[model samples]
Target: PQQPFASSTPQSSNPFGTSSQSTTFSNNSTLNSSNFSNTINCNPTNTMNYNPTNMNPSSNFTTNTFNTFTVNYEDPFLLKDITFEKVEKKTAPFSRIVPKPIFSEATMKPLLNLTYRPPRVTQKKKIYTEPSIEEARHLKEIENLVIGFEGKGRIQYIDKISGTELTTSNIEDKITFLKNEVVVSDPPGIGLNKRARVYVEGIFAFSKSQGDFIVGKAEKYPLKAIQERFVYSLKEDPYKKFVDYNYETGLYVYEVNHF
Candidate 1:
C-alpha cells in the first residue's frame, strides 16, 4: 500500500480538534471507503457543500421546521373585533286636559197664600134615661150575689134567691152559680163607666184538673187563663174587680166571667 499522505500541519491528539476538517464532519455527511481517496475542502465562512454520488432519488427523508413568536399589550382590554351599537330611548304618552263647566244664576218666584182653616166642632145634646125596673132588680141581685172568699180554701158565698148558707173547699163549687147567665158588676168606686168582668184569684189550679166535672163542662173554662189574663200586680186598681180567694197572699188573678 502506498504510504498514506500526511498533512504538513501538526497532528493533534484531540479527536475534536479546531481544524476545518474536523468541523466539517457532521451527522448530515456520510463516510465510506471510496470517500477515503478524496480530499475534503472546508471554507472559513463556516458553510458546507456536499456532493453525494450514486444516491437513490427515491430515498425517504423527512425534515420539520417550527417558528414561535410573542406579543405584549395592556391587561383587561377589549379586542379590536368587539363593537358597540346605538340604543333608542322610549318616552311616556301625554295626558289629556279637561275644561270646567260654567254656572248660571236661578230666578226666584213669589210666595202663595197658604192659610190653615180650623175644623168645625159639633156638640150633641145629652139625654139622660133612667134604668128599667127589671134592669134595676137584676143589678141589685148581682151586687148581692158578688161573693168573695175571706181566706184561702174557704167558701164565703151565700145563695141570694134561696137564702141558703153555701160552704165548699173546691173552687169549682163557688164558680158554679155564675155559670148560668150571670152578669158581672163593675169594680166599686171606680166611676170610669167601663164595663166589668169577673176576675177570680187562684182559679188557675182548675185548668190542670182532670177529675173536676164542673170545671171541665163550664163554657170558656180557665184554659190558658194563667198565661192569657194573669194579673201581675195587686197594687193595680183593675184587680179590685178580682174575687181573690187567697186575699192574704194575692198571688194569681184570672178573668172567669166568660165561664
Candidate 2:
C-alpha cells in the first residue's frame, strides 16, 4: 500500500518446512500432533493362519472338551428321621460237661469180682508153749551153773587117787545136761525142797562122782572150805577120806560122802 513496502534482500527462509497451516498457542490451549489422530485398533480379530510346516513334528498337543457340572443343596438334619432294628445274638450249641471215664465197665469187672469174694478161713497154728514156773527156775539154775563152771578155779573136778586136775576132753560135750531135763532131789539132811543136777563131761568115773559130791555139798559148805578140801584130800586116803575131808568146819558143813 505505500507502493507495497519493498525489501532489499530476499525474505529469510523458515527453519521448519513451510506449511500452509498456522498454529496458535494460548494459556489454556492444548497441542496435538498429526500422528496422534491415528488411533490403534485395540479390539483386534486373530487373522493368523495355521501353518503345518512351521509346527514341530515331535510336539504332543491335544484338544480336550469337558462337560459342565452343577451341584444341588439339601437339609442337613435329614439323618434324624431314619429308624434301626435290634438283632438277637445266639450262642454256640451246648457240648458235654463231663469227660469220659478213664476205665471202662468191661475192664473193671474182674477187679470188682476179686474184691467182693468171701473171706478165707485160716487154721489156728500153735507156735510154742510157755515154760512153767518150776521149769523156768530150773533153767535159770542150770544157766548159773554153766556160768560158774566157765570161771577159773570156781568149780573143778580132780582125780582123787592120781591127784591131778581133770578137764573136759570133748569141749562140744561139755554142756550135755542142758538139753536133758534131769531132776535131783536136795540132800537128805538139808531140809531144802530144791532140785539140781551136775554133769562133768569127759572125766574119769571116780572124778565125776567126786564132782557130784562137791556140787551137792555146795549148798551146805562155804566155797572156801570146799576149795580147801580139794587140796587137803590129796594127803588123806585117796578114795575114802577125800569125800569127808572137811566135815567138821561149821553149821554149813555136811558129810557129803555119806549123803
Candidate 3:
C-alpha cells in the first residue's frame, strides 16, 4: 500500500477495509462476509476520504453519499424593492335639523270645495249593448262583436247623451265596454286625477254652464186646489231607478239633477 498525502486526515477507521464488529480478522485475508460490519480500514489511521479511483473493483467498496446532489440558487422576486405612499386623515363638519309638525285636516281649509272650483275635467262614458236574439244569430253575417273582448272592433256604439248610434267601419274606431251597463263615473271630489278636461277649439263644453232654471214658484197653495189624488207603482228598473211612474196620470216623475 502507498502512503497518504500530507494534508489528508482520516476521520475514522479506513472505510475501504475496516470493520466495526468485535470479531478480529487476519491482516492479509479478505472478509467472506454475508453479515459485515459498518466500515473497512486501510493502511493509515489519519487519511482523507477513500479515493474512488483507488478503490479495487474486486474489493466491492460503497458509500451512502454516492447519489446525493447539492445546489445553491437565488430568487429574483425576493431581491426586488417595493415602495408605498402614506394616507392623510380628513374630518367633516356636523349638521342637525328640527322637523316640522304633521298636517291636520280640520286646521287646513279643504284643498278644494264649492267656492273653490276644481279644474275642468272631460270624461267619455262608454256604453255597450248585448246582442239581442235576432242579432246574435247573425253574428257571423252582420258583424261579430263580443263584449269584454280586448281590442277595438267594427260596430255601432251609442252616444248616451245624444241617444245617437255611430257607425264605424274601422276596428280601432270602436270602443271597448265591459257590459251593457254604462259606466257612470263618480264626480271626482278633488281626491285624484285632477287634470283639466280638454276640449276642441270650436267645441262647447256645456259642463261650465250647468245650472237649474226656476220653472214656477207659488206661495202657500191650498191642498183643495187638487181635488183628485193618485198613486201608482212603477216598474223597478235598475237603470231608471230615480223616475217614478203614476198609473192614474200615465206620467213619469223623474228625480233629475239640475246639472
Candidate 4:
C-alpha cells in the first residue's frame, strides 16, 4: 500500500511528446517479506530463459507489476539490417586502341571522278591598264589610214614645183601666194599653224605640208597632181631630204631628215 505505485505517471506541457515528466517514488515503499520471497521464487523459475548481458535497464517488457513503465518511444531513421563486404581489384591490365583511317563507300566515287582528268587549269588573258577613249579613237584612225594604203600608192604633193619654180616654204608664204593667185570674196582664213621642221635627204616638202597642213601631225609629200598634169613639186614629200634654206642669204644647205 505505497499508494499502489501511483498508477498514472506525471504529465508535461509538451504537445509533440518531445519531453518527459519527472519520476517520483515514496520513501517508505518497501516490498513485504512474503512478496519478496515469492518474487525470488518466480525469478529462479525464469532463470533458464533469462540473459543478464542482454537485459535492458529501462525496457517496457520487464518482470514487474508495481512500476508501470510506459514505452516513451520513437523510430528515428527506419534502418535496415544491411551487411557490407570488401571489394577486390581487377586481375588483368586494361588498354584502349585507336583504328586507322579508311575511305567509306559514299566518298570513294566522288573522289575518283575528281582525279580522272588531272585537273586542267587555264589562266584568263588580262590587260592591266585599259586604254582611254581618246587614245582608242586615235589608234582606230591610224589603222584605217594604214588600210587605205594597202592597194595603191598614196597621192603625193610637194611645195617646190620643179627646180625652176620655187614657192613659199612656210605657211605664211603659202597664204600670201594663195591670196594673190586665187580670187575670192574672202581668202581662206588660216585654221591653225604649228612650226615643225624636218630635214630632207631625197625630196622637198609641199606648201600645205608646212604649217598649213593642220589636220594631222607633219609629214612630207612630193610631186602631187593638179587635175591633169603631174606638178613635179616638193610639198609634203616624205622622202625629201630637208636642208636649212637661208632666206636672207638665198642659200640651201643639207641637214639630217627624220620622221
What TM-score fits each model? 0.15, 0.13, 0.14, 0.12
lDDT of 3 by residue, 1-259 (tens): 4322112333444354653323232332233332343333344423566465565677656678978966435644544346667988755434324444477445667665668667789553433334543444434322323232222111222211211221222112433322222222323222111121111111111122234221222123232112112111223433323333322333333221210
The residue ranges of model 1 lying beyond 4 angstroms of the native Cα positions read 1-140, 153-248
What's the candidate order when arranged by decreasing TM-score?
1, 3, 2, 4
Better of 2 and 4 by lDDT: 2
Query: Which residue pairs clash in candidate 1?
Result: none
Worst 10-residue stretch by lDDT in candidate 2?
157-166
Candidate 2: how many backbone clashes?
A: 0
Off by over 4 Å in 3: 1-108, 111-118, 131-259
| Alpha-carbon RMSD of each model | 24.9, 32.1, 29.2, 28.5
lDDT of 3 at 169: 20
lDDT of 1 by residue, 95-183 (tens): 32444447754776758556786768955222111232334343433322333433222212222221121112222232332221223
| Residue 15 lDDT (model 1) | 33
Worst 10-residue stretch by lDDT in candidate 3? 197-206
120-179 in candidate 4: lDDT tens per residue? 796422211113233434342221111011111111122111221111122223321121
**Candidate 1: residue 11 Cα off by (Å):** 99
**What C-alpha root-mean-square deviation, in Å, does candidate 1 show against the real structure?**
24.9
Tens digits of per-residue lDDT for model 2, 1-52: 2222221223233334332322222232223232223223221221245345
Candidate 3, position 243, lDDT: 37
State each model's CA lDDT, in order: 0.34, 0.31, 0.31, 0.29
